[model samples]
Target: MDRPGLADFLRRRRELLRPTDVGVAEGPRRRTPGLRREEVAMLAGVSTDHYTRLEQSRGSAPSESVVAALARALRCTVDERDHLFHLAGLSPPPRRAARHVSPGLLGVAGRLVDVPVAICSDISEVVWTNTLFSALMGDVGTRPGRASNITWRWFTEPGVRDRAPEEERDRLAAAHVSDLRATYSRRAGDSDVTELVDDLLQRSREFRVLWERHEVAVRRSDHKTFVHPEVGAVELRCEVLLTPEADIKLLAYFPLEGTDAARKLDVLRVIGTQTFATA
Candidate 1:
């Protein structure tokens, strides 16, 4: 937990992402290049000071639509989008436990073995990931208890920072945790969720503050940019499909307009296969 309050959360998340992450180009002399709060406000259609309050914890809960807009401006992932709601104290409708994946979705993922792909739970747990995902993310997804989690390594481990353009990785991790806090607020007494909350809260500080904001979001979807160690610069269009009959979600990735991301993905395919074979 790196971000404790709105101020820290805003500052931290901004630090982690590069200007390119928010669709801004790397400026000539920007020591740090993520979108400023004012810039983000313009994109999100909110007043600059108002948006600043949301980040600084001066303003209270944001409307659902506003949260969604900000998430889009940030190019958040489904997990991140959901987090936006949680931070705003909104509840998305819940579904049953065992959701089904569409054949079309699986087919699409299967066809993109070159790029990392995964199906995640509403809570950001990685339920299933393709071989390339396992290859790119190392063995985390392959491990029994480590699957379906986004912030585990991103927040707690140091190595992950090298893989993304974010300078505030810890802050973003905290934001996710804060989002989870808002989510679990709805099911506060559930043992499993409670335990997870306790674990993360004990493990990180940023989580504690964002959680206090009591934010929550129900909808999902977004774009993501990652600086893969192997793939120098990569942008991905991330989409989340809600499965019928359950709460499960399928998250998939595809390359952005122009980049060498595809070439790096090929390297990941080879690396993942080689790693798994040796294992």
Candidate 2:
């Protein structure tokens, strides 16, 4: 690993960001021009000491996961992220495997405090969720492994459908299967996609039935009714916004017109687990 170059890059990137840029409030006047090292470490889900070592050109090369996390934490662009990988003596992740929430995009989503925003991989892995989204759909992060994967959870766990209206369940299931089928075709022999499909075929008879139908389409827009126990039935217009590389999608749930959905969301924002409601 080009430790010196990686250290320099990390330092430069970290110094370019301010707390507000990443949804942090400006508290207790800071002497530094940008974010503190601890702040970057916290945002990247790493220990402050580890990040400090990297900046000091100490410690071993970061793993791929750590590299990706650093990219997001620093809000690195595609080009910058690749340079980081190169400096670390590692290849940049393939688009699908690196389907992380762009820190820039996450910052943007963070500003939509009242909206339910989530980032999902092309393969339907729930990568990240805004707090409102967690309150609305339940927390994806808390679920373990494939348990947090939207498609896997849908096909394997009936309880995952508790929020969706019973009538809409079948349609949602089919859409998920068909979308995954498209990924399976595009990625043909890629082990990740292949493994998911093969396991699903074995796990769910319904999945096997849907696969047999041979439908192919990417689900872009859909209307969903989330039957939240507290808010009654809340209707939302789900819109998908793709990243520049098209490997990750930003999902924003807007309250439907002419319903009490807007008010319900406002309520959720306030009662946000410990705060308030926007669910």
Candidate 3:
């Protein structure tokens, strides 16, 4: 690894960002020109000491996940992110099919405070979710490994299946399988998608049956119902906004006008914000 170059690059990127750029407030007077080391560490989801060692060029090489997190925290452009990977002696992810969420999409998610919003990859993995989504969906992204995948969870987890109405569950399951099949066709050789398919084929008779149908359909806007534990049943419109690259999508849920779901969503927003603040 180009340790010195990596350190210099990280330092330069960190220094180029202001608190407001990353949705942080300009608090007390700072001795530095940009974000503090601790602030960057917090944003990157790493320990302050760990980030400090990285800046000092004394730590071990970061994993790809760590590098990706740092890239997001630094608000690096696509080229800058690739440079970071290179400096760390790793091949950069493909620009056409990046797994990392874009900063602009994340910014949009941040602005959606009242609605349930999540950023999903092409393969339906929840990369990031807003507080309201967690409140509505029960922290689906916190699941381990492939369990965080929406397709995987829909078929394998009873809790996920239980959220849908009994009559709709079968149709929902079929739609999810068809969506995954479309992704599998698009990214045929991708190991992660392959492993997920293999595992689902083994674990779920329902999935296997649907896969045999060879259905291929892309996800568009749809209506969905959620049986929230606290607020009961709420129906919402699910809208998907594809990024410029079309690799990542922002999935936002909104209540229909003049519906009971709208009132429930307002209650959910208040509860979700409070829960997030305390947590």
Candidate 4:
């Protein structure tokens, strides 16, 4: 690994970004040229000391997860992200269809403060989520391994389906199954997709029935009702923004204007973040 080069690249990238670019406040006193080390560490999901050591060229090689997080935090382009991986003595992710979130998309997600936003992979795995999303969806990032996937949770975990309305549960389950089918067609031999499908077919009769239908449907704009324990029921319009590669999608939830859902969302924002059981 080129330690000095990596340190230089990281420092330069950090200096290029401003507070406003990443949805952070500038504050009153203006001394620093760009975002602070702590701010980047927070955005990248790493310890401040670790990031500092990397900048100082005194840290060990970062893992793929940390490199990906740093790429997102630095808002690096595809080429820059690849360069970061190479500098850390790791192979860059394949250029073909894969499940990875883009740095630009991550930057966009960070800018959305009022709404609950999450980035999901092609197979419906929750790659990243903002704070509001954690409050609404029970901290999906904390789920174990494949459980972080929506389809996996919907089939294997009973509590996950409990959040949706009873009347709509069947339809939601069908939709999730159909979406997984679409992904399975694109990523036929992928281990994650294959294992998830096999596990679901073994564990869930409902999923097995839906999978047999061979339904293929992409997600679109729709209204979803979620039952939050603290805020009760909230109905929000779900919108999806696909990245250029089409492997990652940004899912944002917005409450209708002048509605009780909007008020409930406000209550959630005021409540801040809280821990909830993960499936």
Query: lDDT of each structure?
Result: 0.58, 0.83, 0.82, 0.83
Candidate 3 lDDT: 0.82
- lDDT per residue for candidate 3 within 107-129, as digits (tens), equals 87877878899888877887677
Summing lDDT over every window of 10 consecutive residues in candidate 2, give the lowest-scoring window: 94-103
Native RMSD of candidate 1 (Å): 19.8
Task: List the candidate 2 regions with Cα displacement exceeding 4 Å.
Answer: 1-8, 46-62, 86-89, 95-108, 141-145, 229-232, 243-245, 274-279
- Residue lDDT tens for model 4, 1-279: 889999999999999999988878899996877889999998887889999999999977787878877887888877888899999999998763233566567778888888999888878888788888888887786454687788888888898877899998989998898878887897789787898899889999999899999999878666789998877889999999876666778899999665699888888888867645657
Best of the candidates, TM-score: 4
- TM value for model 2: 0.81
Candidate 3 TM-score, true structure as reference = 0.83
> Which scores greater on lDDT, model 1 or model 3?
3
In candidate 3, how many Å is residue 210 off?
1.2
- Candidate 1, residues 1-279, lDDT tens digits: the string is 112343554566666666644434465777654667777776456789888877666655676556655654565555555555665667532322322233345455556545677766546666456666666665444344433367555555667667665764644554566656655765667655677777767876766666666667543555566765554556666666666532556666677668666677777666654522222
Q: How many residue pairs clash in all the candidates, one count each?
A: 23, 14, 0, 0
Pairwise lDDT winner, candidates 2 and 3: 2
The 10-residue segment of model 1 with minimum total lDDT is: 92-101
Per-residue error (Å), model 4, residue 51: 1.8
Against the hidden reference, what TM-scores do the models get? 0.53, 0.81, 0.83, 0.88
Q: What digit string (tens of lDDT, one per residue) describes model 2 on residues 138-197? A: 878445469768999999989989999999999999999998988888778988789999
